[model samples]
Target: MATVTYAFLCSGVGLALCERLLSQDTERLRLCLACRNMHRAQAARSALLAAHPTAQVDLLQMDTSSIFSVIRAAQEVRLRYDRLDYLYLNAGIMPNPQFDMKAFFKGLFSSNVITMFATAEGILTQRDGVTPDGLGEIFATNLFGHFLLVRELEPMLCHAGRTSQLIWTSSSNAQRSAFSLEDIQHQTGTQPYSSSKYASDLLSLALNTHYNPQGLYSSVICPGFVMTNLTYSILPSFPAFLWTLLMPLFWLIRMFTNTFTLTPFNGAEALFWLFKQKPESLDPYAKYHSLTSGLGNNYTQPRKMDIDLGTSESLYEKLLQLESEVRRKVEEKKKEAQHAHRHLAGSVSS
Candidate 1:
């Protein structure tokens, strides 16, 4: 039997998925945690190995926000693996999130309270900025970095006889209105997190349209309202005790809507479900959601996303053009650094 390889782009629920995968098929599967933090990655590897002694879990240092880091990580993967069975594009950020407490309080009395709580739709916004690459940090980390990684690993993912899966950790908050075709980076938006996720939804459809023939399949999933580090960052001003106090309220809200998949394990249900499925069996137009009942039972459901083929194709083309421009800039920076190094060396020798 051929060994299956899985690469996850973040920790949190990605680590949970790793545990699920290894518990069932430790001997036959190789798991790689591609994370920006080597320390956390090493610790996660240790914990997984401690639980499943013989499982193969490797670590790749990758900062998805940095173009050079993503490129280097992809190169490393190419050298280490001949085939990749699954790639979880789960790394994301909602830096400096601003929660509208007034809106939150007002929404509690409204008919759409369930929707507001489940998706944080009207009550959440974020402060976003640019990366060193001049790409919006949220856009770079959440979507384009994963896109570039897929492009770099096309050899393994698009192997002729075999198939590969790309599972994106999208969200219930990914509103169609948040994203703009002209400003793909969400430069002027307060909801960069939502915009980035919406972009991922569009990109997944485009990937299916473009690479399904090449044996590469892409699907997007929402982890519901998971209480990971990202969620904690939403209210940085709040004390730890305040969140603890709000847990009961959250539980009550979960009664009405199953989108409050609060734990990483629960959030990973949809992702883990997809692992058992044949990529060809999935609905490319549907966004699979990980849901949990008030009683805490977990399940997966698919909802059709508000997207169009025309828009998806247009985004794909724009990404291709941006990729070309980014590569040129990276090459020019490399050459300039080399030239400066050579000049310094010559002067020192003289």
Candidate 2:
């Protein structure tokens, strides 16, 4: 039997979903840990090997936030493997996150408390910035960069006889109202994280529609309220001990809604579940959520996403346009640099 190849983009050390996924069946799986930080990637690879010495784990360096880095990574992937079975678009960011204590208190007494916690509707906002590529950092890191990677690796992903799956780590916080086609990058918004996630859902649906005939499948998942580095940044003012003390309160909230899958292992439930499923058997319109019950049992549930085919297609087109613009700019810069180098060399010789 051919071994299954799984490439995870931006695998977090210790709290990564890839670690749990690899632990399940390391011998049969060829794991690729694609991350920006070589130090963290090496650490993650070591930890995985330590637990399962026989596991086949490889590393690729790529910062999903940078367009140039993504291009180089795609080239490396093409050279390394002929075909990729699963591409876990799991890397994401929420820069300068600020929790709304006032809104949290008000919502506690309101009927929307559960909704607020589950979806983080009015209780969370993030201050986003621009990337070196001149795109919104959150949008680029969370959505467009992955989109570009998928586009670049289309040959491997869309095989004639076999199917490849793109599993995106989206969120329950992805609200329809947060996304705007007019401002797709959320350049002027305080909630770029939410906006970008919503865009992922739409883009997934679009990918299925466009590539299903060619055997490429796309699906999105909500790793429900996982307490990773991203979550820790939200309430940085709260000491680690204080956050640990609030575990009971969070557990109590879980009884009302099971979306609070706090640990990365629990949050990865849907991602692992998707691995065992047939891509064609999945629902494109649903956002698969990783839920942990009050009893601490973890399971994957699919909820209908608040996106339509029309909107998804529109977003897909917008992404294509942005991709073209960025590529063009990159080429122009390369040419300018080459010209400047030649001029300097000529002057030096003279």
What overall lDDT goes with each candidate model? 0.92, 0.88
The TM-score obtained by model 2 is 0.96
**Per-residue lDDT of model 2, residues 183-220, tens digit only:** 99998778999999999999999999999999999998
Residue clash pairs of candidate 2: none
TM-score of each: 0.98, 0.96
Residue 37 in model 2: shift from native, Å?
1.4
Query: What would the per-residue lDDT of candidate 1 be over residues 201-318, giving only the tens digit for each residue?
Result: 9999999998999999999999988888888888888899999998999898888889999899999999999999999999999999999998999999999999999999999999
Relative to the true structure, candidate 2 has a C-alpha RMSD (angstroms) of 1.5
lDDT of 1: 0.92
